[model samples]
Target: MSTTSVSISQKLTLSGSSSCNPRLAQAPWEFDAMPGYGPGSSEADPVPAHAPTNAEARPGQLPQLYRELPEEDLHERIRAAKEALGEDLVILGHFYQRDEIVQHADFLGDSFQLANAALTKPEARYIVFCGVHFMAETADILSSPEQSVILPNLAAGCSMADMADEDSVEAAWEEICEVYGVDPQNVTPDDDGKLPILPVTYMNSSAALKAFCGRHGGIVCTSSNAETVLEWAFERARRVLFFPDQHLGRNTAKAMGVPLEQMPMWNPRRPLGGNTAEDLQQAKVLLWHGFCSVHRRFSVAQIEKARSEHPGVKVIVHPESPMPVVDAADASGSTDAIRKFVAASSPGDVIAIGTEINMVNRLAAEYPDRTIFCLDPVICPCSTMYRIHPGYLAWVLEDLVQGRVNNQIVVPETVAAHARVALDRMLAAKPK
Candidate 1:
């Protein structure tokens, strides 16, 4: 399939939730429970080994309590749960989460920052992550063995991260190795102290992929430091194979003067990624066929509309956006970076942002003096991120209050060891 076709299909899959509001999808604790029980329902159910127990709603039906509970009541319960747990619990919220959930966060930042934040609070027994599934896994990999990480909703998963599975990536690696005549078991360095190619994975990927990078002399990168990581890779390798985000790799490499002709998209299903041997040999960066659904919704037309309607409007977008959108914007960075850009602006400055709706709305509310709005006015949130509702937050925190560990995310020791190496390398890499 073409890149556009792939993006559309993934968008449909990512947004496929039973509830009209994705956030109302059944929580893991709701499943198999008695029908009359609500959010604080203590009634036990026989949880299946493979199925999620927190899921409360019947197939195609939304949870009654989550839908009916007043916002004030939810807040009160969440507060009571947190106060009961005290310092024993540390809630980390990503900027993309809804304001209701973020208001209860002990630490609010991007994924990489939150992972480091998890390490700082070693005293906390539970780390409740108000983010997607992969983020909870990263926390599990980084936190101490004694500390348990919890993702409020088990259904919360990243579409972009799911695009590049381990099997497909391994297959691609083998094909590239054959093309370059390099051995994974025993790689030989060139005269310039560089290997043939290095794998660089974005932090948005799975922990297994991070381990893959660690084993292959590769490193992990976040949007804020992608350029630095790529520079580090190029110094030690002839070319780089970046996974789980084609736009980021392409935009970052292009900014460093790497031409588009030298960056080939790798569709794992296609033979040799649909490239000739000569093309593969000449490539500077092999980009995996993946993209962020939320970021992909942004368009150059939105930028134009913002400019036309609001004169002197400053447009800022996430680097995960398409190249055209990023190029059109005045600035592009991570979610935190976009927040910083808006924060630094003068009062009365109109700013248009291209990112998740929850964050944009929160920023607009935070900086009332400045006119802030999302470029896509249709309210498109990261479907996975939105799965984390305040109701789920209350449920998990209350579980801790009851001296039970519910929905704890634990990365296997063997996988965690390798994943940590790549994460450490990312933390050590200095910005260019």
Candidate 2:
């Protein structure tokens, strides 16, 4: 029987967090455990024999005791459970996670980095990912079959991922196939050895999409390796169709000297995805109509403000931000790249970052010697990332200590088998 992919809890609400709010800014552990994003939404067939056998058994409420505990007690509880579990448990914290959650992380980095980190610890049976849904799903995909990946809070879902669902993309593919008068099922190469279009999905997408790419001879890409991934795709196909984040696709392709006119945004709502027949014929990259709300919030105005306020300020932005914001900054990269840029700077450098609030704040705390701050003066963490409160971490860990696997994220073998193919292609694209 097929179980839906990981539930989309954060999809229910944008986010109840605000950096401006004193309570939310503090260590507030209390939260609602919203569940399910419809059935059979973003996954595949039969459960993996090696995956958590009790896939049907998942987390429910946030346990009143966890919600009621003071910040110190909550942290102490997590530490105690972590100590009790020992090598059997490994906590992976996304860079966007709150400081409270980060403190308990055995491994800390971006999602792709964290997934690779899981492989380093073969002895750890439980991977508690203090990140969002897609991240936990990735850990499940890459980790040992005997291991289980868990998300502390079920509601921590990425809004950008939700933008490109499986069904809509399938529909788009069929339409594109009709335009090229080629079979969508099999992308045969021409005499020049280039296919009509090659699909390239951002790592932020659902596992179902990754499987789609694998089945159709496409590949996956993390933000850090988009350029390399694109180069790989171009070598195989005449053009590309990038999904779930138009900004990333646009910015990366633009840097590679792909003209703006040749990169058309695909709007699922319109016929031919809002492109004329000629646009599709001339298209080099068909960017999906999707984006990250947090990155999209950044604008050219914010960079200008930072420059005026801090003399000789060095600016850097994530490519997920709109093209204008990326253009205004001195450099554009993935989460890891942004961190490295700051690390390499002189101690006295005034660095203004355009990304999530929690990450920027964490960096500020890390490098007290440098003048580091977020470009957006208004405090707002990524709505979804903030869903992972410390309360949930304490609850899940304690439950694991009790021999109960709550919030277990299990990807079906059918899905993981195909998704891994696409993920492997991404790994191969890494710079040597």
Candidate 3:
């Protein structure tokens, strides 16, 4: 709801920062940023006045100027980055990142997992986040202010994270309070309290959102730990109001055998609690109408098609997928879980995966003997992640090498304290 800043420790080693060190695995590829051709630093290739601009032009006349740039000296750059920065810089990669980038990551995991990984790295003065914007922001919030956090590309962001913003959250809170005569701040234990109006936000939200949950006596949850987190929330609250992605909340609750009729959809724009008698009285969970555009593209029909076309085709989907998509899949989990499954499965197994395109492509390459394809065979990527091209990563790393730090994400002080409240609650929750 409001912004605040937090101070971070400037230590550079991962040991002093986090309580534990994450075990990293070697990647199949390498990162190479050529010396002279850094992002936004190269001399623009000049267009000759005589060059033909149209496709109708003859091949020679069209553009002899289209020469490929030299490939980055992968090993050399990696050695340089490691040697120069040492513990001062920590590179974090999400499981969904391309293999090329993942190869260079000091830490690799899902969004919340990566943030948890970054928090323990107190030795690092700088964190170069390789995931979406919200993730980097989360790192900033969780870490000390002295430690700088940079997103390789300022443009990099997450669609699912963007679905709910400050205004929307405030508006919803206002309506809930107005209709129910319940203060979000005053909810507490009762001998027979109907259910606490507990707010469960996904990890894919802004730091401010997390802080809102924290200040309001709520907690945060990731895809892998949703069930346990929800169980924790339910014990304290009268009813759970899960935000951003309705699909994840619905799917997890359903698996727990909570009937579909008990979960109501919250409409912030509506009054009367934004619910019908059946929706409010019978509700166990209140799901928001947000979803990931990428995951939502996966359909039951696609899974059926994959099964029909190939025998033993296992369908694995992200929890953010639509209800039907998750229902049709053989299994569902977080990005890291999906990768682990593919890695552990026997060779020659056919798998249809529902997640971001880059991850699916990487899995297909890694497991050549096994058939792997996207559940939605469309040519779309996580638009925010698409912003983190090799060029962007190189530029940010280069900046850290210099005294300049561009696009540093900082979670404000007040917000960080409140957000920590929610995160602390989550950390205390036992696994189901």
Candidate 4:
């Protein structure tokens, strides 16, 4: 895809001068200069060195000037930039993002929906994704070549996605091939002409892994359609390797009547993935040891508390939550599913949601008559999702107005071609 510069008749002036925000002048995560503190560093605290120190930092921090600017001024600048750019720009926001950023989004939905939204906007030259890193990468893989996908903050990365890197997964695949006595080069299909094993990656994974799936005849799946994708895999493969989130894989497979004994966890750190040849042979689904930090926080205790405090409360959670938490909740679904659940509820209905704090708060405000609150009283937002501050949004948009593309996410041509096959298969899989 060719990258085109946006031209504006009038240069939009930001609320604060460039001097006021020194960090904004340069990318925060310049890991090349800091040898020991780049992304995926083996430090005790896995956060990148350039991650924001706090929501409010001293004058030198990247967002300090943004924090200092009046909310009205920031809003005004964002409006002006959007108006000046017109249809060439499209802003996509996730439900979990903070109100400050979500309010400025032209389209709001979950990651999969947002990726599809990017495809629909063929006229949009730039897709400013107000979500995490992987979501932008997905948009880049699916959108037209002429369209450029921009991520506001480089630090906005998914911890779950980081857990299952391409190197680790590739290594695991080789070990599995040996354990199953299957040749990676020449795989003999079953009597039914199905492959012995298939790799099914969650939509939250990297583009490289999606390409890996495409090359191996596997497909991608979102939380909303995981079961459907799994069924599709099972029909053509004897066993499946599901990755990035063990909770989702286990829960979905269990519901489909797969026994726990048949599902084994693959620990990348251990030899043979911490499983014996016998264990591998009996496995129906090999799950990766990865989970979402936010969803992992939910517990059955929280569900009980909601039930005790408000009798007849409806408990709905994301499928990423642990099996027990999902089982205890009244229902579990994707972010869009949670929204629809609340919208379908009657007035005065007491609903306790198990998701990010920002989304629950927004729902409460949108439906004032209904009593909607987060299950966990303590504040816990997706730290990665929170990285897309309004300041970053303004910075990227303003850069576009000046005929520049900042933090653009582009997948390699071969990778995009392969990844698109899996994504297209996902789009075709009908939900049964």
Whole-model lDDT, model 3: 0.69
Candidate 4 versus truth, CA RMSD in Å, comes to 9.0
- For model 2, what is the error of residue 59's alpha carbon versus the real structure, in angstroms, after optimal superposition? 5.4
What digit string (tens of lDDT, one per residue) describes model 4 on residues 1-432?
Answer: 000000000111132311111122222333223322222111232532323332322122344566567657877888899999999999999998878788899899987678778888999999999998788989998888899999887667676787788888889988998877788655568778888889999998989989988888889998878999999999999889999899999999988999999999999989988999898999999999888766887889999999999999999999899999999999998898999999999999999999877788889989999999888654445655755666778877887999988889999998989999999998787554
TM-score of each: 0.86, 0.88, 0.80, 0.86
Instruction: Itemize residue pairs with steric clashes in candidate 4.
Output: none
Off by over 4 Å in 1: 1-68, 430-432
Using TM-score as the measure, which candidate wins?
A: 2
lDDT of each: 0.79, 0.79, 0.69, 0.79
lDDT of 2 by residue, 357-401 (tens): 678877887899999988765554565577677788999999999
Colliding pairs, model 2: none
Which model, 3 or 4, shows the larger lDDT? 4
The Cα RMSD in angstroms, rounded to one decimal, for candidate 3 relative to the true structure is: 13.6
Q: C-alpha displacement of 432 in model 1, angstroms?
A: 5.6
lDDT of 1 by residue, 1-432 (tens): 222223323443465431122222344334324332222111231122322333442232234675467667878999999999998999999998777788899999997688788989999999999998788998998888888898877766676787787888889998998889988656667778889989999999889999999888899999878999998999899999999899999989988999999999999879999898899999999999888766887899999999999999999999999999999999999887888898899999999999877788789889999899888744456656765667777777777899977777888889889999998899887444
TM-score attained by model 4: 0.86
lDDT of 3 by residue, 194-230 (tens): 4447788998888888988887778998887899998
Error (Å) of candidate 2 at residue 283 is 0.6
